[model samples]
Target: MKNLLVILFSQALVNNFMLARILGTCPFIGVSQQVETATGMSLAVVFVMTMASAISWLVQHLILNPLNMGYLQTVAFILVIAALVQLIEMLLKKNSPGLYKALGIYLPLITTNCAVLGVAIVNIGAGYSFVESAVSGAAGGLGWGLAIIVFAAIRERQQLAPIPKAMQGFPLALVTTGLLAMAFLGFSGFNVAKFVGM
Candidate 1:
């Protein structure tokens, strides 16, 4: 249990997909204009990442490794991720039209999001068990969402703050992201593996 908590915290903070791994930047910038949209995207990402990690783990252990087909890992993982994104898209379209529309192209673009694929590949590389992979995937998504939402809040306020014309838009957001990433770097010295007894 302590190990699981450590994994979750490590992924969600110390090794955030956004601040640390630097994945899924497209939607991080696109859908993060509003907190509501960011929340919805984050929930969807958490669900998909968790499920994809589990399924990919099963496929790797059960099929790929057994048949000596390890070379197909990337293709196999992307296929799984693409299918999951499509499924989520349909479900969202039917259950929540407003969110579906708000998400727009970004929802479908999740198929290519490096964070999703990165989690699946990282799970396999780390040799994490099924439960750990799921936890890590969800945590990574949570971290990505946390970073984007917080950055969105900052941008929201920045809209009103009198700022230099040169750094009004993307330039300012980029600088803020760099600073936030540096702040997250402070967690690097805290050894998650030591706490988890790994």
Candidate 2:
């Protein structure tokens, strides 16, 4: 339990996919115009990331290792992630047309979102078991969700805040993202494992 908690904290905050590790910047900026869309995207990412990690872990240990085809990890993981994203896309389109439309190209882009792949690779590299890999992936997704939602809120508010014309869009968003990344950096080397009694 302590180990799980530590991993959760470390991945979600200390090693945030967006803020700290600097992965998945496309949707972080593109889908962040509105909190509603960002939240939708976040939930989709969380589900996909969690499932992808779990499935990829199984493939790595059960198939790749047994066949001594470890070199195919990236290709295997990509296929897995792509398949999972397609399933999600279908489900969302059938059940939630509003959010499905809101997500636009970003939904498919989740497959290419390096953060999803990064978490899976990190899980294998870290030698985390199935449960740990799932947790790490979920945490990574939650971290991404948190960052995008917060950023979306700020950007929405910025509409009314009278900002200088030069620093209106991307410039301000970049500045905000940099500051958020710096803030997450404060968690660096904080010894979360020690605190969690790991």
State which candidate has the highest TM-score: 2
The local distance difference test score of each candidate is 0.90, 0.94
| lDDT of each residue in 52-170, candidate 1, tens digit only | 99999999999999999999999999999999999999999999999999999999988999999999999899999999999999998888888988988888888889999998888
Alpha carbon lDDT at 109, candidate 1: 85
TM-score (C-alpha, index-matched) for candidate 2 = 0.97
What CA root-mean-square deviation does each model show from the true structure?
A: 1.5, 1.0
Q: What TM-score against the true fold does each predicted structure earn?
A: 0.94, 0.97
Model 2 poorest 10 in a row by lDDT = 189-198
Candidate 2 off by > 4 Å: none
Q: What is the C-alpha RMSD, rounded to one decimal, of candidate 2? A: 1.0
Residue 193 local lDDT, model 1: 80
